[model samples]
Target: MKITHYLYNAFLIESGDKKLAVDPGGLMFYYFRFSPLIPKSEWNNVTHIFVTHGDPDHYWHADRMAAVSKAPVICNKTMVQEIDGKYLLLGPRDKGVAFTTEFKNHHKLSVDETIEVDGVTITGIKTTHGPLTVKLGPFSKTLNPGRDERIGWGAIGFKIQLDGKTLVNLGDTLLHKDEWESIDSPDVLMIPIGGNAVHNTMDIPEALQAIRIMKPKLVIPCHYNCPAFFSKNFNHADEDEFRNELEAMDIQYAILHKGDSIHV
Candidate 1:
């Protein structure tokens, strides 16, 4: 299997003649004015689209990708509503057109539920978004917890099995031990280490602990390094500490830059 990172969490996975796109959203910090990290033409052959959450940066451009590839979108219950959907509407738009999300077929899965397309198996692993924190200039406050997946776009992870390889993408979320217990050891684990004061996803230490528990063969970190102009709580720290720990434990890993691809 081949993996390509396209900024943020957008990843393109190629296996044989099939291609799968995960979290195909924008580089939101750039005000959504620039081109996608991965070009539209590259996505023309996508066979499946998986959205981890409904944030603009996550699913903002899923419709576009789906339209180009004519692929089936697999997402949470909120996106599977199947009714006419409303969206932030990426790219230039005409006034009063009522931008909405529509797909020929949407495969919705709840936590722990698994679906198979062709020969690949896709499972909706448990996940949670960060707490709702209201930031006030130099000060910040936490309003509510983020464990509400019942609300639909609450967030979720995915375990993709193809060609005897297993890869898990733990969207934007904290370490949920209970849910993690359900996930078997994966060949590649994509976790978010960009923990913030508001406690969105696991931080360096927390992510390390998760690594110890899940025990994946290859670990690729995500959810960090939001451009200063694009965020307030994001930490742009280097991965030396993370690497040192992983190296100490002799865990296989790779640090992927935008547009970089690796075989697993």
Candidate 2:
């Protein structure tokens, strides 16, 4: 199996004759001028695409890529209702915030369901997208007039099993102790280490704690340091800090930059 990173959370997974793409959306947010990341022309081999949520940065290029690759898009049910053939894609949002964008074609999957696409068996795991806020341009403002608000959207993680190996992709999520009970130990674990202090996702310490619980043989950090529009300050998670933590716990991990590929 070979995994290639493309900017933010977008990734290309190649195994034998199958190529799968995860979260192809990049730089589509209204705040950014344009996506710094561009889809490669060679994506013709993609057979399946997985989208963890409806965030623009995660699903922006999904329809475009699917059109070229002729791949089936697997996403949550809300995302399925958001597409009309290929032009307008809509997703459930808080009042005043409607569907985000339109796409060409899409297939929706539900949480806890296992589906086989091409040769891969993927199981959707439950996850939370943290509190929701009213999105305004590049910034988000709390919606509640006076009281603190807790907003959550339907988000999910994935456990992809193929070729006798299991790889887990935990989309944007906070470290929830219950998730450990739902997922089996995987061969490779792709986790987000950027949203730590922000509370939107796991930080370095929380991710390390997750690693200890999941005990995957290999760990890859993702969903951090992409376009400036998505994050005000962008920097790859402190890899050295991660490395030291891994050393103390005796965990093995690999850090890949955009456009880098790993073969396993």
Question: Across residues 1-264, which tens digit of lDDT does each residue of candidate 1 receive?
Answer: 899987667889999988989888766546335346567878899999888876656776788788888888887664443234433332212112222545665677888889897677998888877764535489766644333432215377899999889999988887787668766679999988877554667788888888888899999987676532246335454588888889998998888877788998
Count clashing residue pairs per candidate. 0, 8
What C-alpha lDDT do the candidate models reach, one value each?
Answer: 0.72, 0.70
Best by TM-score: 1
Q: Which candidate leads in lDDT?
A: 1
Model 1, residue 94: displacement in angstroms? 14
lDDT tens readout by residue for model 2, 150-174 = 1333367889998989999887777
**Regions of model 2 farther than 4 Å from truth:** 28-31, 36-38, 82-106, 132-153, 230-232
What are the candidates' C-alpha RMSDs? 4.4, 4.6
Q: In model 2, what lDDT does residue 45 have? A: 80
lDDT agreement of model 1 with the native:
0.72
Q: List the residue pairs that clash in candidate 1.
A: none
TM-score of each: 0.84, 0.82
